[model samples]
Target: MKSRFTPLLAGLVLAVSSLTVQADEVQVAVAANFTAPMQKIAAEFEKDTGHKALLVFGATGKLYAQIKNGAPFQVFLAADDKTPAKLETEGDTVSGSRFTYAIGTLVLWSAKPGFVDDQGEVLKKGAFKHLAIANPKTAPYGAAAVATLTQLGLLDAIQPKLVTGENISQAYQFVVTENAELGFIALSQVMADGQMTGGSAWVVPSNLHDPIRQDAAILAKGRNQPAARALVEYLKGDKAAAIIKSYGYAL
Candidate 1:
């Protein structure tokens, strides 16, 4: 009986050892707009692959700056394709590791229900005193907001009422806190399971602005990290794609 138990114990120990050796951690820098979906994806990724994703969220430009300054992030999920392409050109990312993970949708959101119309005529109506947007210089969603307003011929008219946040998260906060009447933000921020989680929102038409092709890549710092490589591949999987779509992002 003792000998039989000894072999079982040895097998269990070896299995546990194998699991420990297989698990790895990756530090990921993610765009602010992708916060909700990325969280879900990270959880699924860990469950499926036994690889942990340690995520940091920020504006794309700021994250790019941090990456350039040697931040420990091994993976980057940028708000736009351009930033990752620039990094690739600059040799900051692993060659051939970059891919577009999602296409983002911008929304005009108000914490108050029925405050924004489905057609997004609120900008032209100009009844609100303050409208929030992320700093266009550092956030692609903000840039898209600007583009939308421009396309609608409301930029000059709405400029005076603009309240800017450092990033999309902050812009969303401004609306949530009632500091601004409404804001331009990522659809993912206000959506879950193909419905608005709360408040009123106008899904900005895709043709109003440049397509927000969000991309991801393994950074040079993660070139040798298995977890980083795994994460890049995981984002392309059906589970991750479903989560992204559930957040109102296009795959």
Candidate 2:
């Protein structure tokens, strides 16, 4: 009886040990524009892989600065592909670990219904007292907004009316709170399930600005972290792609 019980006990111990080894947590620095989708993806990732993602959100540039200063983040999801590539070139990321996770869309949005037209003629109309935009120096979407304005030859005209936010989230907040009549922001922020979540918006044309190719990478700090690698792989899977698309981003 003792011999038979010994083998069974050992098997149970081994199984528990395997479970413990498989479960892990990773710290991730994510772009503010990706908040909603990343939250959903993180939840799904934990349920499917038993790996937890601890997310910290901010503007891509600020996150990059933090990472440079040794923030201990294992994975980085940036608002533009350029930053991750720069990290790779700077030897701050794992080689061949960077990938484009989502293609973001910029939108001019207003919290009030019918306030913005589909053609985005409002910028030329210049009817609003305050037009909110993220800081172009730190946020990719804000740079895109500036580019679009430049292409439309309205940057000079709209310069004085501009209200700048530190990041895209804060820019959206300005519009939502009516501090600005409308703001340039990510399409994901105002979209859900293939429909506008609220108010009105003008989806900026791709030709108006450079493509917003958002990318992800495993940082040097996460080089040997299993959870970090798992999260990156998970982001490439079908489930994560669907979640990303549902938030108004492209593959």
Name the regions of candidate 1 deviating beyond 4 angstroms. none
**Local distance difference test values of all predictions, in order:** 0.95, 0.96
Candidates' TM-scores? 0.97, 0.96
Error of 1 at 207 (Å): 1.4
Q: What is the C-alpha RMSD of each candidate to the true structure, in Å?
A: 1.0, 1.4
lDDT of 2: 0.96
Q: Lowest-lDDT window of 10 residues in candidate 1? A: 117-126
**Segments of candidate 2 deviating more than 4 angstroms:** 1-10
The residue-level lDDT of candidate 2 at 113 comes to 96
Cα error, residue 141 of model 1, in Å, equals 0.3
Write the residue-wise lDDT of candidate 2 on 36-126 in tens digits: 9999999999999999999999999999999999999999999999999999999999999999999999999999999999999988899
Clashes of 1: 0
Best by TM-score: 1
